[model samples]
Target: MTHHLAPAPLLALTLPSEDVLYAALLARDPAFDGRAYVGVTSTGIFCRLTCPARKPLRANCRFFSSPADCLAAGFRACLRCHPLAPEAAADPCIAALTSALEADPARRWREADVAGLGFDPSTVRRSFRRQFGMTFLEMARQRRLREGMATLAAGGRVIEAQFDAGFDSPAAFRAAFARLLGAAPAEMKGALLQADWIDTPIGPMIAVADKRSLHLLEFADRKALPAELARLRKMAGGIGLGRPQPIDQMADELGAFFAGTSARFDTPLALHGSAFTRAVWEILRQIPPGTTRSYGDIARDMGCPEAARAVARANGANQIALVIPCHRVIGADGALTGYGGGLWRKQRLIELERGYALRHDRQPDDIGQRADGGEAGQP
Candidate 1:
């Protein structure tokens, strides 16, 4: 398969042309570290713009919008820059703490815990807050709460949920639950949706769903993510933080998508929005995986040509990421516009889909390519 990217006008505006990107690479600009990746054709390696290694000749360089793109182009990660690592992985302390948290999310983490872990509490707090917009303790608290929610979603007793979540007292657990969920623990026993996190090549994403359908999917770093979850909780009557069947299915589908094996999503969706917004989202779903449409094109298709701005607003409001294909919508002039997940992510997604489309079209037998060091030349 030979995947051809969409026209330049349809990609995000943040990406510079090859010549400009090459100039940035030659200068070794730190500003472009996470924004772009360079694939050295001669060496078959990709590197971050801030890599300390010597620059390759411009003629041998093939600029990519993401590390995934470089990998797709049959390039390996640069040892010096560790281009495959997430941005947060640059901080050893953050990496260690996050690994510990992932290992035991139910642990009752405290300020003393940081001290015991060989980190200054104040320094750890500052670093975590700066990097993730939340204190380490706060993250632990949320993790415990999620565990409790998971227990409840899995049909455990309230007391079991509390203790399982690492809360020492029932009153404390109830108070925390009420504060974050706007409902007492006992009052949340009804059919509740589950919220969980899934890591992607771009970043971590939060997925919320009930047994039947997905409700919300957004990047964890989005500022409005908390508020979006709150809205869903309120609308759902009650929601637990856990891994439900729907979430598992979503995780599998997302894994397949990033791997380039499949772009089609069969997980059911539970959309919550105004009628007009729902209409716009439905149209967005109709967009093919490798194709794109301008906001004006969508609005005009809906027989509301004058409502392009309104359509764009609805596009921004969508919580579901790749599933709804909102990233496929572009500005009238074909430049990438605002996306809640960030323009860089939008660009990467477009490129990924283009790669997949190219592979599928040319080699019908070759379904896709995985980003994690699988077959490179396909999707």
Candidate 2:
């Protein structure tokens, strides 16, 4: 079977040139990181360009160059092979805001204040809503109320707790405390807030993290979701789920990526995979947003060119999606291949990246490649 990334856009985004895109796939260039993805029409799944599954036919191959392109076309993500989890999350501003809010439970941040930190208010709001299913202000307020609960548990005076939490008035603080803990600040001391919930192209995702770092990222539909939740509950101990700040940041970065803004991500990620898989994922990270590669090429790059099939297996096993960029990997024949998402989405992702590549200042001689990694020596 000859798999190929999309050579044109399925919707608003454009696919990379067939030849150049193929080369990236063949070489597993890692240069195309998050900018492009592939879908297998035959299998009804989408994957990062780095997926190692057997190649599908060109006619059955569809390219999606962006995450938005895939979702816009209505392709669901693959479950057995999770494609949404990326290798390393590196979104700095989001991380910083999350830390600051957690550290100062009493402080309230205004939209303008967040914007002053170099993010558009709308972007921040949207990111939070998509990932954590809440707005920043809402999350922050919840944090404050949780702090009040803790202070109360420690036997602090209600008035002092309110002021210590940076609340201007005791009345306002008490109201918030009641809303979250089901009572006023004076009613309970040991109560706390827990965090969870996020939506993705595949389905609703759940995340639980505290002041330190994000601890878990799992799909809600997983049969083991209950067990996963249990683990989180235990990990958090008494911390409980408060405002999901990290999830919000992920949602925002993903939204921009799908839209093809070329805005690099700086989210701190916790890759949960074997050492080899983690290594493969890291290599995928180095691939530029608008480039691609092949399983064989990736294997060779890793000093095991003969282990191309092994490379593909690792790609198929990737849980994180856009960040690790398995979508950038294609078949040796330059056709769209196996993807956990769907073929239509793959075609669309490729098209979006190619469009960006066309406008990305490539030299004239390099313009002829399809970006699929198949056109290396073909006439």
Candidate 3:
């Protein structure tokens, strides 16, 4: 007698060919843990492949290699799976410390404080750095600063902001603020260049601008941000905090870009670079939103085939972020290269651009900043 086999699940028919990641997502496969992540477009959240939460559909799934990649695609971390935890808490020390951090995010953490928790400070540091690319202390400090910025943005006094940040000294608080933002809380008066936080789908960006032109824009968490802001302060005039007209304008354009409503960054940019770099950037802006170009291609376009390396350098040097569109450049072999914002963000930008309705292709329109400000477009 012939044996009868069970029918395959109907879901298998809907999956992309050779879709191993989605299969792993459905299976709650431990093999893909830390090796794969899934972003649920419908829920706007990402999860580990082993996440036990009810699975999303194939149509809504976007797989990524890491949490950073999911974040760049505007997906928030799955609180249930704790996908953002370093190594998903492979180390017991990391698990405990991160749990404590989640419980008390504003707690002022010190090396001694970490030691007090019965963890070897050095071990904890190494574990966190190896897993998260940052020490536990640094992560704690950034959390505190996020809280502090919330206080300041809501029109609270500087001392109130400092207190909220859990800083022991007002001076130390001001110094940290200056280190991150290139200006003390008190010095945010009417300086020539004003800075404000513009929330995008990927991250919070600090946009520094004058009345009519944007000068500097970079992700707040970028490693080079403080130094870039310092240089901008030196080259331009005093750097202050508060939304200038240009900052307001940039915030709106960013809103449109992320919404896929428009890819036209028409806000006047005050490009700061050598003439060659400036020329390279102009070529960058001309590349259509949905298309990418190689650095070598850009060099060839500039009539300097030998300048491909220089073009790559200029692409890395661009501080204006999306406005200058440096993320559009790729390697000669069609590989995505380093973006100042992170490779995850570069991938997301490319993914996002593919959906954009280019401004040149559509009728002109004005989009205004929301009166309700604070971390807009956060998913």
**Highest-lDDT candidate:** 1
Q: Candidate 1 or 3, higher lDDT?
A: 1
**lDDT tens digits, residue span 151-232, model 2:** 6545678887787666888888878654543345444323232444555543345455544445555543333444544544
Specify the highest-TM-score model's number: 1
Q: Which scores better on TM-score, 1 or 3?
A: 1
Ranking by TM-score: 1, 3, 2
Instruction: Please give each candidate's TM-score.
Output: 0.64, 0.40, 0.62
What is model 2's C-alpha RMSD?
16.6
In model 1, state the lDDT of residue 107: 88
lDDT of 3 by residue, 1-379 (tens): 1111222221111222327777777887554454457888877888877666777778888877557778998999876666775333546787798779878979988998888889999998886664444688987887687677768866789989999998989998888887788678877665788777887866578888888888989987778888898888888767876677888888887888888777667777888888888887777766656466778777877878898999999888888888778877765533455667765466567656654523333543422111111111122
- Can you write out model 1's per-residue Cα lDDT over 255-324, one digit (the tens) per residue? 9889988886778888888888888888877666666777877787788889999998898889988888
How does candidate 3 score on lDDT? 0.71
Compared with the true structure, the alpha-carbon lDDT of candidate 2 equals 0.56
What are the lDDT figures for the candidates, one per model? Answer: 0.73, 0.56, 0.71
Error of 3 at 59 (Å): 28
